[model samples]
Target: MSTALNWLSALDHPEFLADRVSAALRQWPDGDAEAVQVAEIDPAIADTSALVAATDITLESSANCLVVRARRSGTETLAAVLVLATTKADINTAIRKTLGARKCSFMSMDAAVEATGMEYGGITPIGLPQDWPLLIDERVVAQDQIVIGSGVRRSKVRMPGPLAQQLPGAQVITDLAVPIA
Candidate 1:
């Protein structure tokens, strides 16, 4: 954990973590030392741009989790995609091909919240449904640290970049996200 930032142990802030995030952290290997730090923030600033402006974090160090839906032959596949705030997921091309779906789009806010059981604007990849693939942009894994959602709107989770690779069903994909000009 970085000594510069004020970070609370994930174990100490159940109220700030989504139920699934808390449970996952509890089971994470202690030897991995990549401890996830929870930091309380105003819900109003939970969005990436606002969060960066309001806190010490930077836009490059913040990752956004988005729920993408793909449909094929009446079967719907939902995936949780994590991308750095400075880029956008290539949903129309890369993700669509990976999902093997003819159509793909961002999941509706209502459906995303209902399926993840997390608040809108606070969906982290940690507690996603087991069946859903967790697509992590390669750029995100290259960072030393990042701030991500805590499954709720009042807090954020900070952890080592490599730690995201340990997430269930997580797949690091190059070009998963395209840089934004």
Candidate 2:
């Protein structure tokens, strides 16, 4: 859990990355651009649970992205599931229905990593392939701000949840049922 470098700053040409997210922010229309921030941690060393536990931030206020792969007949596709950190996405039923596949399941870790060109813990919706499906949990919209993977494990980015919904190729959904607290 102990860490050394600032994770977020590890990105190459961070200013350029900021500019990209900034451009997307401008299109948000109702978004508060100030909500986004870059934080650092050991992305490669931790799973979502460990990453969340290592931070002082509230779990309910963060969003996690899970890269999922589903197959229909002989065709294989990739989808990203976004959910509140306090909850987990229901990939079995929800994702299957969305993909209209009689059978849907998660891809192997190796395939997910290869498809997204992102390390497992660092996958985000911002710069994913256009063909990948993006599914977001409805609860994310209820938050004022949410933390998400910054496309790299050692770093994270925070922003208005809706902004994440509006990313190109993103399709927000409430398929995941939030467990009663």
In lDDT terms, which candidate is top?
A: 1
| Each model's lDDT | 0.88, 0.66
Global lDDT for candidate 2?
Answer: 0.66
Give RMSD (Å) of candidate 1 vs. truth.
2.8
Residue 128 CA displacement from its true place in model 1, Å: 1.0
What are the clash counts of all predictions, listed in order?
Answer: 0, 3
Number of clashing residue pairs, candidate 2: 3
CA lDDT for candidate 1 = 0.88
lDDT tens digits, residue span 1-181, model 1: 2113368977777778989888877777985434788888889988988787767888899999999999999998989999999999999998998889999999899999998999998899887887899999999999999899999999899988889998889999999999999
Quote the lDDT for 64 in model 1.
96
Pairs clashing within candidate 1? none
- The top-ranked prediction according to TM-score is 1
lDDT per residue, candidate 2, 1-181, as tens digits? 5343243321333542333343444454443444556776654544666765676656787687777767888887778878887876777788778877767766677887787776667766666776777888888877887777666666677677767766767777775636536
